[model samples]
Target chain A: MRAVGAEEVAPTSHPWEIQADGLVVRVGGRRGRNAVNELTLRLGRGVHGLLGPNGAGKTTLIRTLATVQKPSAGSLSLLGTPLGRATGLRPLRRRLGYLPQHFGYYKRFTVREFVEYLAWLKEMPPEAIPGAVQRALEKVGLADRADDRLKTLSGGMVRRAGIAQAIVNDPEVLLLDEPTVGLDPAQRLSFRELVAELGQQACVLISTHLVEDVAAACTDVVLVSEGSLVFQGTPAELAAAGTTDHVGDSPIERGYTALLSAGPGRSGW
Target chain B: MTAHHPGEQLLRQYVRGDDVPADQLWAVEAHLESCAPCRGRLAPDPIAEQVWADLAPVLDRTPQMPPARSWLRHVSHWVSPVAGPWLAMILLVTAVAVALDQAGSVARGQISLVLLVAPVLPVLGVAASWGRAMDPAHELTAATPRAGLPLVFRRTVAVLAVVVPGLLVASQLTGASLTQWMLPCLAFTTCTLALGGLIGITRAAITLIAGWAAGIVLPTIALSRTSVALDVAATPVWAAVLAAGLIVIAVRFRTQSRSS
Candidate 1:
C-alpha cells in the first residue's frame, strides 16, 4: 500500500468576536506548582456577561482574553490580531483596555497622574494626555476627585480609579473583571452607565458571578462552567432557558442558578 | 424618506444576540462568508512589513566603525561610580604598598609591595564594572518588557563599553605599562559585568566581594615568599583562567535571564 503521509490541515480562523471552535488552557502557577484550565473565548461586540462559581475559571478566561495567560491548545485573536503573531503588543495593548480583578496603584500619585501615566504607556501624545485623563475621570464620575491622591480615595473611589485607568485609552476591546466587586449600590449604578457608554464604542466583556450587574449592564450573557461555555444568549433567552413554569419573569438570579445546575451544554437557564 | 438597509436589522440582532429566526442568521452568515472586506476585518493585520520598517532605521543608525578611542572613553565614563571610591582607596593603599615595597626591596624584599599591588588595579577594575552592572534597579527593570531587547543589551554594553577605557586611562595616569596584562584586564572587567548581570544584582555583589578578597589578599600572600616569580604582576595563569570561567558563567547566566 502506498504510504499515506502527513496530511495538510488549514488553520482555524478567528474573528474579532470569538470564533473558537475548541480552546483549552493549562497554566502552571509561578513555580509550576499549580495548574488550572481556563475557558475558551470567541469574539464579538456588545457586553458579554460571564457567570460561574469561584474557581470555575471565570477570572482565568478573562486573563486569557487579556493575553496575560496563554491557552494550552486552540486559537484566539483579539480585535482581529492573532496573539502570538503580533510581536510588539504595545499597539494591541493601546487598543485593548482591561480592569483586572485587582491592581496596584501608586498611592502617592494623584488621580490625574495615574491616568496620565497609563495614557503615556498607551503612547497617547503629550497634548492628548490632559483631555484623555479628564474624559476618563468624567466618564467614571470621578471628576471631583481628580486632584486627590490614591491613598486619600475611598474604597469605592479607588475601584472607580481602577476603571478610569482601564478606559483612558478608549480601547477597542474592554474586559472588566468583577467591576462591581467592591462598589456600593449608588457607585454600581454610576459604573453601569459608564459601561453602557463604552459599549456603544467597543466590545465590553464583564465577568462577574453577580447576576444583578449582568442584568443591569449586559445586553448579552455567556455562562461558563467547568472551563466551557454552557450558554451564549441574551438575558431574556437565558431566563427563558430556565424552568418553563418560571420562564417569563424569571429573575437573573434564578436563571443563573438554573444554568449552572443544568451543567455544561444543558443551557437550562 | 429614510433609507432602510436590509442587513441593518440583522446586524443589530447579531450584536444583541437575539434569537433571530434561522433563515435571517443563515443569510447574514452566507453574505459574510463571501465578503472580502468584511472577512479582512476579522483577521489580524500581517506584521512582516512593519517589523522590517521598524528594524531598518535602528540597523542603519548603528555606526560601521565607532572611533577606536571612543570605547575607552565610554568605559571611563561608566567606571566613575566605583572608580571614584576605588581611586581614593588605592591612593592610600598605594602609598602604604610603595613604602612597604621600598623598605622590603632594600632589605630581603627584592619584590616590592608596589609590584604586589599591580594586580589590584585589574581586580578592582573588574569589581567596579561588576558593581555598577549589579545595580538593583537594573534587575527590576530587566523584568519588564518595556525595557525591551535593545534597551537591556544597550545598558549591559554601556557598562562594558565604559569600564575598559577607565582601566586604560587609570593605568596611564599611574605611569604603568600594561603590555602583558592588557588583554586579561579587559577580559576580567567585561566578564565580571556580564556575570554580575547574569547572576542578578545581589549575587553579583557577593561574587565581587569574594573576587576582591582573593585578588588583593591572595596576591600579597603569594608575594610574601622570597621567589621573585610570586609578584602581583606574575599571577599564575590559573588566576586568569578562573576569572575567565567566572566571566563565562556570568555571560551564560545573563543571556539565559534575558531570553527567559
Candidate 2:
C-alpha cells in the first residue's frame, strides 16, 4: 500500500482493467434467478481471489466474465471495451482464457494436442502454438505427460491439463473457476506460484472456496454473497475485519464468515 | 548470455539512431537483451527514437503466413476424431444398401435400397457431431468465440463431405438418378439444421429420421415402389424446402445475436 508514489509515475493512470456497473446475469434459463444481480466491481492487474459460499453466484459471475454467459441487464466491460458492442466479441475473446468449474475435456486427446487445439480455438498463430503449448505444459509440470492421453492421467493431472490449456494463449484476462478443485496439496502450491507470476501482467481471477489459497497468493480479495458485494480489499484488510467474535478456523475464514453474516443472505455453513 | 560485450563505439551507434551494420546489429541486439549493465550504460531514449528507427520495420507489418495444408488439417480442424467412427458407420450403411440393391433381394420393381438409406446417413453424422453426451468438450467448446454457427456449419460440412461422396458412388452403382436422391438428401440435412436451431440438433435429427422411417421409407419398402416424397413431381418442392430451411437458419442466428 505504501508504493502509491511509484504507481503514480507509471505510464497509465487507469488501473481498472475490468469494470462492471450494476451487472446482472441470469443463469439456467429464462425462469432462472439473476445469479449475478446488480453487482458492481473493478479489478486490475494482479491476482484477485473471488470468495463466496456455494450458490453465491461465484460460478455465474465467473461465467459472465469468461464471456460464456451474457448479462441480462446492466453494464459490463473488459480491457476498456464494453461488451455487446457492434464491433463484436471475437477480438476480446482472443485475449481471454477461461477454465470452467467442471473443466470438460476430450478424453481421446493427448495433453499437448488438447492444449494446441484450445490455442487454435483462441486463434493463436499456427507457428506460435507449438512453443506456447510446450511452455504452458512445462509451467504446470506436465511436460513429461504431454504425449499421454487425458484418460490416462490422474485427477490432479487432468486439472493441470485444464490449467495448461487455459494459459496456452498468454491471455490478458484469465478466469479460473474452481481451478484447484482436483489438485493435490503439492500441485496446489505450484499452481499458486504460477498464478502469481501470471498476475504480473494479466488480471487473473480465481473463484474458489479455499480461503487459504486466497491468503497465500492473492493480492486482493473480493467477497460476494447472494450476487452482491460484501467486501473488496487486500487479504490483510480482510483478516483485520474479523475478531474473536466470529467463528472460523483461520483469520481469513473468520473474516469471511463475519462478512457473510453481515450481508443480506445467510450462508448456511 | 555470452561473456563478451559489444564495444562502446558500436553500442553508441546502435543507441544514437546511427546505422549499425547488419553484421554487428544482430550480435548487439542479442547482447543488450541479456546484459542489463550494457543497456544501462547506453544514452537515454526519451522519445524511444532509437527503438522507432531500429525495430520499426519488424513491428510495422507481420511476416507472411504459411498457407494452410488444405488437404489435411483443413479436414481435421473442422472434424474431431470421434467423427471417424460415425462417418464409418454412415459408409458402412451405404455399402449394405448397395449390396442389397445388387442382390435383387425383394423384386425387380422394388425401390432401390440406396435411395432409402441416402437421406438419413448424414442425419446420423450430424447427430453424433453435436450430441452433448457424445462430446465431453461440449460446454468448453461453447465457451469459445467460434462455438456457434461457425462450428455447427463446419461439422455439418465435414459430415457432408464424407457421406455425400459415398452416397454418390452407391447411387451410381444402384442405377439411381442423382437428382432423385441428392436434392432430398440436401433438403433433409438442411431441415435437420433448421429444427436444430430451435429444439437442438440431436433431437431434431432423431425426430426427422423417425418421421422419414414412418411416413416415407416404411411405405416405400412395403409397397415396393418409390415414395411420393422422392417422386419426380416433388423435385421443385424439395428445392423450396431447402431454401426455406436456409432462411430459417439465418433468421435464427440474427435474432439470437440480437437478443444476446
All models: lDDT? 0.60, 0.83
Candidate that scores best on lDDT:
2
Could you tell me the lDDT of residue B91 within candidate 1? 58
Q: What DockQ does each prediction reach against the true complex?
A: 0.04, 0.24
Over 4 Å off, model 2 = A1-15, A85-87, A265-269, B1-75, B100-109, B210-215, B218-225, B247-260
What is the per-residue lDDT of model 2 for residues A153-226, given as tens digits with 9 covering 90 to 100? 99889989888888888877999998999898999999999999999988999999999999998999999988
What TM-score does candidate 2 reach?
A: 0.79
In terms of lDDT, the poorest run of 10 residues in model 1 chain A is A1-10
TM per candidate comes to: 0.54, 0.79
Top-scoring candidate (TM-score): 2
TM-score of chain B of 1: 0.40
Candidate 1's residue-wise lDDT over B1-260, tens digit each?
Answer: 12322365676675567998888777666766677665444443469668878988996576432222334334433343234455555556656665665455534664444434444444454444333253322221221223332333343344434444554444454444554335444444444455554564335545655765476546555665533333345555636755775667566545645443
> Which window of ten consecutive residues has the lowest lDDT sum in model 2 chain A?
A1-10
